[model samples]
Target: MTTSIEPGPSRYSFDNDDPESVGRHSHLSNILDPFTFQRLGTLGDLAGKRCLEVGAGGGSVARWFAEQAGPTGDVLATDLNVRHIPLDAGFRVLRHDLVAEPVPDGPWDVIHARLVLLHIPQREAVLARLAESLAPGGALVIEEWATEFGNLCLAAPDDEAAGLIDEYRDTLVNRVLPGRGNDPAWAARVHATMLANGLVGVDTAIDAASWPGGSPGALLIAVNVAQLHDDFIAAGFTEERIQRLYAAVQDPRLVVRSHFTYSTIGRRPGGS
Candidate 1:
């Protein structure tokens, strides 16, 4: 089958090349890996299955997949930038663009992408392609951040600090992310999209936990703020305001509920 996948007008908002991104990915892995791994575990034993991990930041989950799939299994990890994914790991690594490049040949048993598709403007199309690439009885697991409930500031030292957190989220989620072609609300639509694409037994599980200041979740917020500092400024956030927001997120007194993580999984039909 041939495809006419074209590059989108904008690329990912975060850059893996930045030195700070190492810490960012680490923080994300620490915060999200447990849930991601648990979701993958639901597929039962993957001893000989072929797995693909897309947009594999820091390669933590890919490494986990390698362990689960074992020596007889095949695991491939791919991303637009693979600087952080080590070649020495027990899996194959590919630096491939999801937009302008052809997807690798696959009748894969499992394909997983975390916090990836929401950043692509042509996500629905890419999703269709991914679904088509699945092997019979294969699973596609997508984990995305949804802003439906917003990033709630549950506790703060004061009302002013709380307001700053809200303002920062407004700028980041509404202005900055969209400016980079991200769809902040895409998570809610994944289920319907999967169903429309003829995937079976689609399920969406939502999870969120409170993040206190100085925790991995809060640190992720700080890392993102630093990485997107310029974009935040371009979004009309003053330097002083940005600084305050950063400090607020680390105040220890501040507690927040991060955006909902929607883990949507589906299976292809007809396999034993």
Candidate 2:
């Protein structure tokens, strides 16, 4: 599929090449895989299905689905940052943009994207495109963050830390990032969005995490700070505050509950 409208640039790009961020995403996928599989399991055997994994960072879920699909089914894993997903059996990866280009022509039996659409300014249009790509009765599962306010609250070991996080989230994170076109609220509206696009049986499950000191989420918080330090500085956050937050994040005693995410599922209306 070829068309040139320019996918353009995202407000923020994941530094996939960075060792810290790469390691963070790898563990991130492991931590979040179960909730996704819970929904996937309900879809029954993928032995003969056609599946698409969009923005398939790390590609763990796509690899699993390809295994389940066995010899009969096929799976395509895609991301703009194309990394080689493990398990080549019945698996393929593509460097594709969900917004600008068409999905592979064959209608999909299941389409899944986690944390993908929220980053897109053209999310609604892409959602429409996803619906169009589905085979009759295909399921689409979208997992995304519901609110960063909950994530913000995790910074509090005390009132002082809480205040710092509140300042950081409100001033630096939310206002600065959204200007580039990421919607942290889109997860909460998945059911409504899917229904409006003529999908049926739309359901949502919200999941939040409590991270221990050595856990993946803890690392992600630190990695995020490293990635966005410039943005924070530009947003007028003090160098001192950034340093404090960075130090606080490394505390071995730290524990925090992250914001919730919705693993929302909807199916195209049609028959087997």
Candidate 3:
């Protein structure tokens, strides 16, 4: 097991109290989480099952797991820097570093990670570790954004604002990512990775959605624009341009289309 943390690209904060982070959390819990649960719910009840939730940001999903597992099952919600989460007897939080160690304890019935592996330098190793942690007949679910420029776009384009948005996006892609030039399309390979790592019944899907003026995605992106204003300035973007794009994101007439979100699910063979 690797005892050292792998250096990676600059990560966007998932801080619990920060407004931007809160907005992003709301976006996930209110919008994306339901969509995810709908898919996983089809797999059947989680009652009495142990779940492992990686990168448990605000712990919304962790809470969901606890509710589904009821009082009988338990969940281990972990992150490097956990802030706020509603907890219960069945749910517990741990400050864990995936790169520095293997899963604390598992043979987990369900392992789910969202937007986590893409930021980690040792993603492949981490995936192997997660695979190993799954119990026979367990399920692993992973989701990541195919986060590239062309993948995300402003639906109601304002040429002027578009230019600024492009500039900010470019800075993130070129200057800010904290990894060793890892593939941006890594999420696209998740299904294959899980299959190769000794999983079966692998399946994959992609989703795209429109963020209308006041939608969670809009709010989240608006937060992102404000959060990274300083970075954009440091990257040679003008304050005026950045401010303009920020305003545009908040405009009710503006529509933003998120990049395609990719998800994969695989199961360990055997009865739980």
Q: By lDDT, is 1 or 2 better? A: 1
TM-score of 2: 0.88
Q: Which ranges in model 2 have alpha carbons more than 4 Å from their true place?
A: 1-12, 84-90, 148-151, 154-158
Question: Any runs in candidate 1 off by more than 4 Å, and if so which?
Answer: 1-10
Instruction: List runs of model 3 lying over 4 Å from the truth.
Output: 1-19, 88-90, 149-151, 178-183
lDDT of 2 by residue, 125-220 (tens): 898889889999999888887655644555446676656656756764476668767787888888899999999999888887777545776667
lDDT of candidate 2 vs native? 0.75
Which candidate number has the best TM-score?
1
- Of the two candidates 1 and 3, the one with more favorable lDDT, higher being better, is 1
State the C-alpha lDDT per candidate.
0.86, 0.75, 0.74
lDDT of 1 by residue, 9-32 (tens): 324677887878899899899889
How does each model score on TM-score?
0.94, 0.88, 0.88
